[model samples]
Target: MPKLVRDRTLPALCPFCRAEILRPGEVEGGEWYDFAAGSCTCGAIFAHDPTARNGGAVFLQALLMVSGGDMDRAMELAEGVDYDVGYVQKYNVELHRLEPNSFGTLYFVRLRALGGD
Candidate 1:
């Protein structure tokens, strides 16, 4: 007789509402886990699915390409995605200087564009 096995992975939590996330499947063209859940208590549907690569790097690259490397326009795009222009500006300054870290790249990018890289 063959033994049965089960997959055990901790459920992801929603960032906006702090609710338990229900994994549907892999995000389209993304390796990170994708989750869906009921509307948040705050009346907002929160969806968080990060890409397989560095988000910040991707975001910076896109912004540079779209805005022609204009920091001010990049800030505007960031604001359109519900991201704080100040925060994007702060990080972009470092990114423009060729800083040596890819951390928070995705977050910065998503917050800026609200779209995948």
Candidate 2:
């Protein structure tokens, strides 16, 4: 495991609500074998992609979290209508900063109300 370092100047934040985010932790009973994840106060779930590749898996993890681990429910929802997606690229999980030229990314997913309200 790599040592985590924080950037004192800028704090990592949630893309949806701009709230300072907590460090990613092991997800309990998650779908994948091993993954780091966290959530924001505004109901957005995020998955850390250290390589910035595997975005599809990261996104699916987040969507599944928001959908209560229901893959069918997660797949049936339409983007922008049933939910919204946001991401912070160039993220550094160890440093907790959006470093320039980095390849890490944090994929976020927030579900919308079903009534079209």
- Say which candidate scores most in lDDT: 2
**Candidate 2: which stretches are off by over 4 Å?**
1-9, 114-117
The lDDT per prediction is 0.33, 0.82
RMSD of every candidate to native, in Å, equals 13.4, 5.7
lDDT, candidate 1, 3-107, per-residue tens: 877533223333434454343222333222232112223332322223334444444543433354466765666445543211111121222221233222122
Determine the C-alpha RMSD for candidate 1 after optimal superposition of all C-alphas: 13.4
Candidate 1's TM-score: 0.26
Q: Write the per-residue lDDT of candidate 2 for residues 1-117, one digit (tens) a residue.
A: 998986444567888779989888789985561558888888888988889678998888988988998889988989988899999888777877777767888888888773235
